[model samples]
Target: MANLGLLIIRLVVGLTFVGHGAQKLFGWFGGTGVTKTGEWLESIGIKPGGTIWAICAGLFELVGGLLFSAGVLTPIGAALITIIMIDAIVSVHGRNGYWLTNNGFEYNFVLIAVVIGVALIGPGDYVLFYRP
Candidate 1:
């Protein structure tokens, strides 16, 4: 049952990240694609926020999400997610306070906590590969 709970968390969060990566990289799922996303990043003062950075962010999300969902290299997956979330908080959400209602860092903080908690807790029994 505990493993089941972990699996459920992994699937939901990981797949959601995969979708977000797809949106940024391929413009699928109503995403703005690399160019537009880059433009947005530039607008946000991410300096050199162009194709390269966009690709990097997309790969991090896609690959990290994949590893996380598959429960392979769980630590690395968690690290990647953590890095992205930290970047998000620093670059985008740290302002406007801690509430999501004001476009704050609330959601990103929760994600960070979740990934970190899962990392500390271990990916559990229902994983594709287990490394402790």
Candidate 2:
């Protein structure tokens, strides 16, 4: 019962993060490649003028998302995402305030909490992958 809930949350969040990473890493979901994304990052003052940050973000989101979903390296996964969300709250969402309707940090804050929850509570044994 509880395990199912945990598994679902982990996987859904992990897959979502992976999808986001894929967008940047491989341009799978209309995500710009590292080169273009690098430029975009520079504009936003979020990423430096190189592909490293982009690569890191993509990998984190990609790998973090996957591990988070599968309940593998879950603490690390949640930590990675929690940190990222913190940055998001600090960098972008801070000025927006709370509440998605007003374009605020509420959603980002919630996500950060979720990631932290995953990290702390971990999967409830419903993990379907990473058999080892």
By TM-score, the best candidate is: 1
Query: For candidate 2, which ten residues in a row score worst on lDDT?
Result: 123-132
TM-score quality measure for candidate 1: 0.94
Residues 1-132, candidate 1, lDDT per residue (tens digit)?
999999999989888888888998999999999999888888888887467778888888888898888887877888988898888999888977899999999999999899889988988888986545
lDDT of every model, 2 decimals: 0.87, 0.80
C-alpha lDDT of candidate 1 relative to the true structure: 0.87
Q: Count the backbone clashes (under 3 Å) in each candidate.
A: 0, 1
Q: What is the TM-score of each candidate against the true structure?
A: 0.94, 0.88
Best candidate per lDDT, number?
1
What candidate 2 gets wrong by more than 4 Å, as runs, is 128-132
